[model samples]
Target: MQKVTLRFSHNNPSCLPDYRNHSRSLKKVLQELNIPTWQRKRIPFLYYDDELVAAIGFFVCQAYVLQESEPSLHITWAS
Candidate 1:
């Protein structure tokens, strides 16, 4: 069985994704929009005509926490 592993470092509280194999990151995406990368709770979400365009990943805070299990990621793409 193939098992996936998530590295959780106690040194850094923020759970950042591993970018070793990733080409484009959140910072790269936001750079296209000319937004500065800052540690914040509310990230800049793009919306068009009341609809979510894309997630640039300029999040300000953690979305949520789970009690006994891994938290589910929910993206609100407005329409």
Candidate 2:
């Protein structure tokens, strides 16, 4: 399974204790299975910044996925 270290923000070095464990499990399962791209799921997390945050999961059903994506600035500024 693919593993990744996710930090909600630069200020928060660690995730909440409760969610830290579960989040790890979810990520593992998601990585191992052949999930579809259109199937959207949200991984709930507890941010160290004292707030709850969630990472939206989108499985591309492909190998070697990149953890993050760069927004299309041109599209955003076009309007």
Total clashing pairs for each candidate: 5, 0
Off by over 4 Å in 1: 1-23, 39-41, 44-79
- For residues 3-72, write the lDDT of model 1, one tens digit per residue: 3222211122322222323334445534655754453223544333333333435332222223457755
- In model 1, the Cα lDDT at residue 2 comes to 36
**Clashing pairs for predicted structure model 1, backbone only:** 40-60, 41-60, 41-61, 42-60, 43-58
lDDT string for model 2 (1-79, tens) is 4333434223322222222333333344444455543442433222323432333342212222234674322211111
User: At residue 33, what lDDT does model 1 achieve?
Assistant: 51
**Model 2 bad stretches (over 4 Å):** 1-24, 42-79
